[model samples]
Target: MQASRTLSRSGVAVATARPVLQFLAIMLIALVAGSTFGIWRGYDPGGYSALTFLETLQGAVGGLNVTLPLMGAGALVMTGILAVMARRDRPVAVAYAFAFVLMAVAAVITRFANQPINADVVTWTPDSMPANWTAIRDVWWHWHVVRTMLSMLGLAVLVLAIMADRNRSSAPSA
Candidate 1:
C-alpha cells in the first residue's frame, strides 16, 4: 500500500511538472537562437563589406521568423499555467509570471525595434547601401543584447519555479 501510494504521488508530481518542463525547453531554444545571433554579431568577419553582412543578417532574420513565434507562444502558455497554479502557490506563480512577462517584453523589443532594422537591411544592395548602414547594424545589435538578456533571465526564473515546485511536492504533509 505504501509503495503504491508513493508511485501515485510520483505520477502526480510528474504530471504537474510537464508544463514547466515544456516552458523551460522553449526558453532554452530561444536562448540558443539568440546566443547564436549574438555570437555572429560579435564575430562578424565581413564587417567591412556591406553586401556580406547584409546577406548574413538576412539569413539570421529568416531563422528568427520561426523561433520567435515559438518562444512567444511558449511564454504565453507558461504564463497561463502559472496563473492557474497561483491559486495554490502564489509566490512562485508570481515570480514565474513576471519572468514570462519579461520574455514577452523581449519579443516586443525584437519585433518593434529589430525587425525594422532587418527590413531596412534586406532592402540594401551593395551599390545602393546607405551611408549609415553600420549605424543601423549597431542599433540591431543593441536590441538583440537586450532581448537575449531578457530571455536568459526568464529561463532562470522558470528554473527557480521548478525547484520550488519540487520542494513543495516533496515536503512532509501535516
Candidate 2:
C-alpha cells in the first residue's frame, strides 16, 4: 500500500512538472521569435499606403510566417509529450492538453489559409485582385483573429491547470 502511494505521488510530480517545462520552453521560443519579428515589422521600409495594401499584407504575413511555425511546432511536439503524461481522469489537465491540440490546429490553419492569401497579396495590385478577393480576405482574416484569441484563452487555461497542480502538491499532507 505504501509503495503504491509513493509511486502515485511520484507520478503526480512528473505530470505536474511536464506541462510547466513545456510551457516555459515553448514560451521562450515564442517570445524571442515574436520580438524579433516585431522589430523587423516595425522597421519595414514600406510605410502603410492605400495603394500598398499588398505590401502591408506581405509584411503581416511575413511576421506570422516565423511565429506561427514556431508556435505550431511547439504545440504539436509538446502536446504529444503532454498526451502521454496526462491523466484522463483529471478534468483540468485534460482540458489543458486539449488546448495544446487546438493551438496546433490553429497554427496549421493559419499556415495554409493565411499564408496563401499573403502570397497572392504580394504579387497583386488592388485592380488586379480577384473578383472575390475582398470577401476572401474578410472571411479568412476573421478566422485568423478568432484563432489568435483562442490561443490566448488556451494558454490561460493551461497556466491555470499548472498553478492548480502546484498548489495541490504544496498543500500540507493529510
Candidate 3:
C-alpha cells in the first residue's frame, strides 16, 4: 500500500474503509450492548419499585435516553454499511451480513414487542396497575433478554469479522 490514496492509483484508502466501518459498527453495537447490560443489572424487572413501574421506567430515561435513538440508528446504519462493504469477500461478507441481521432482529423486537409494552406501561400509576402487572412485566423481560443476547452476539461476530478481514489483508499472496 502506498502512503495515501491521495495519488488515486495508490488504492490505499479503499483498504482502510473495511476496518473503519467494522470499528464503527463495533462501537455502536457495544454502546447498545452496554445499555442492555445496565438495564438488566440496575433496573431489571425483579427490582421492586415503590414509586410505580412507570415511574421506574420514566426515571431511567434521563441521560442515556437521548442517546439511545442515535445509538440504535448509528448501529444499524454502520452495520449495514459494513455488510455492503464486505460484499465481495464472501466469508467476510457473510459474517457482516449475519451481524447486521442480528442487530436488525433486535431492533424489530424493540419496535414490535417492547414498544407496545412500554406504551401500556406509560399509562400506568401504582394504584392503576392491572391485576396482571407481573405477567406484562414478564413478557417485557423475556424479550429484553432475547434482544440483549442478540445485540451482544452481533458485536462478537463483528469483532471476529474485522479480525479475519485484517488477517486476510496481511496474508502474503500465493
Candidate 4:
C-alpha cells in the first residue's frame, strides 16, 4: 500500500511538472536561435545590402511563423497551469506569474519597438535604401537585445520556480 501510494504521488508530480518543463525548453530554444541571429547581425551590420537584409528578414520571419505560435501556446498553457497551482501554492504561482509578465513585456517590446522597424526594412530597396538606414538598423538591434534579455530573465525566473517546486515537493510534511 505504501509503495503504491508513493508511486501515485510521484506520477502526479510528474504530470504537474511536464508542462513547465516543456515551456522552459521551448523558450530556451527560441532564445538560443534568436540570440544567434541577433549577435551575427549586430557584429556585421554592413555585411548585407538592403536586398539581402530584406531577404534574410523575410526568412527569419518565416521561421518565426512556426516558432512564435508554439512559444505563445506553451506560455499560455504554462500560465494556466500556474493559475491552477496558485490555489495550493501561492508563492510558486507568484513566481510563475512574474515569469509570464516578463515574457509578456518582451512580446510587447517586439511588437511595438521591433516590428515597425522590420516593416520599414522589408520595404527598402537596394537602389533606394533610406538615408538613415544605419540609424534604423541600430534602433532595431537595440530593441531586439532588450526583448531577448527580457525573455532570458523570464526563463531564469521559470527555472527558479521549478527549483522551488522541487524543493517543496521533496521536503517532508509535518
Candidate 5:
C-alpha cells in the first residue's frame, strides 16, 4: 500500500512539473517581449529635447536593468529544463532547442548591440549629448526592433512547442 501511494505521488509530480515549467518559460519570455514592444512603440523620443530624452532613458534603463536580465535568465533556464526533459522525444526536444536558440539570439542582440548605447544614453545631459546623437539613436532603435521581433518569434515558437508536446502526449498509441 505504501509503495502504491509513493508511485501515485511520483506520477502526480511528473504530470504537474511540465506544466509549471511551460508556464514559467512562456510567461517570462512574454514579459520581456511585451516590455520591449511597449518601449519601441511608446518611448521613441519623437523629437523630445536631449535632456528630456536622457531622463526618460535613465528611467527605462533603471527598470530594465533589473527586469530584462532576470526574465531572460528565467526563461532560458525553464526552456532548457524542458528541452532536457524532452530529449527522448526527438521532435519536441528539437522544438524546445530551437526556441532556446532563438531566445539566446535575442539576448545576444540586447547584450552586444543595444546595451552599450543604453549605457551611453543614460550618461548624457543636454549639453553633453553627442553631436551625432541622431545616428546613435537610430542604430539603437534598429537593434531594438530586431530583438523585439526575435523575442516575439521565440515566444511563438515556445507556444507551438508546448502545443506539439501536448498533442503528441495525448495521441493514441500505435
Candidate 6:
C-alpha cells in the first residue's frame, strides 16, 4: 500500500514536469532562433548593405516560418494534455498550464500580425514601399514586440512552476 502510494505520487510529478519542460524547451528554442536572426540582420544606422540586408531578411523569414509553427503546435498539445491532469487547487500547476495557452496566443499573433507585415514587405520595392510604410510598419512592429514579450513572460512563469514542483518533490514526506 505504501509503495503504491509513492508510485502514484511520482506519477503526478512526472505528468506535471513533462509539460513544463516542453514549454521551456520551445521557449528557449524560439529565443535562440529569434536572437540568431536579430544578430545577423539587426539595424545599424550608419551601415548599409542592400545585398546583405536582403539575405538576412530571408533568413529571418525562413527561421520564423519553421520554428514558430513547430513550437506552437507542440506547446498547444502538451498544454491541453497537462491541463487535464493538473489539479485546480495547485497554483504552480496552474501557472504552467497557462504558459501553454500563452504560446497559442503568440502563435495566432504571429500568423495574423506578423505574417501580413512580412507579406507586404516581400511585395514592396524600395521606391514604392516608402509611401506611408512607416506607420504600417510601426503598428506591426508594436504587435510583434508585445507577442514576443508575452511569450517570454509565459515561459518564465513555466520555469518558476517547474522549479517549485522540483522543490516540492524533494521535500521529506510527513
lDDT of 5 by residue, 121-147 (tens): 878877888998878878888998899
Best by lDDT: 5
lDDT of 6 by residue, 33-151 (tens): 36534543464212434444344445566666667667666656655555555565387568667776676677788788878877666665555555655566566657666676667
How would you encode candidate 1's per-residue C-alpha lDDT over 47-87 as one tens digit per residue? Answer: 55777777778777777655775666666576556646654
**Top TM-score model:** 5
TM-score of each: 0.75, 0.65, 0.84, 0.71, 0.89, 0.67
lDDT of 5: 0.89
**lDDT for model 4:** 0.67
Q: What Cα-based lDDT does every candidate model obtain?
A: 0.69, 0.60, 0.78, 0.67, 0.89, 0.62
Clashes of each: 0, 0, 0, 0, 0, 0
Model 5: per-residue Cα lDDT at residue 157: 92
Tens digits of per-residue lDDT for model 4 on 35-148?
535655564555666666667766666566346635755765565566466547788878877877877777777778877887677666677788877778778778777877
Which pairs clash (backbone N, Cα, C closer than 3 Å) in model 5? none
Off-target runs (Cα >4 Å) in candidate 4 are 1-55
Candidates in descending TM-score order: 5, 3, 1, 4, 6, 2
Q: lDDT by residue for model 3 over 101-151, one digit each (tens)?
A: 888888888778877887787677788888888888889889889988988
Instruction: Give, for candidate 6, the lowest lDDT window spanning 10 residues.
Output: 44-53
Candidate 1: stretches off by over 4 Å: 1-48
Better of 3 and 6 by TM-score: 3
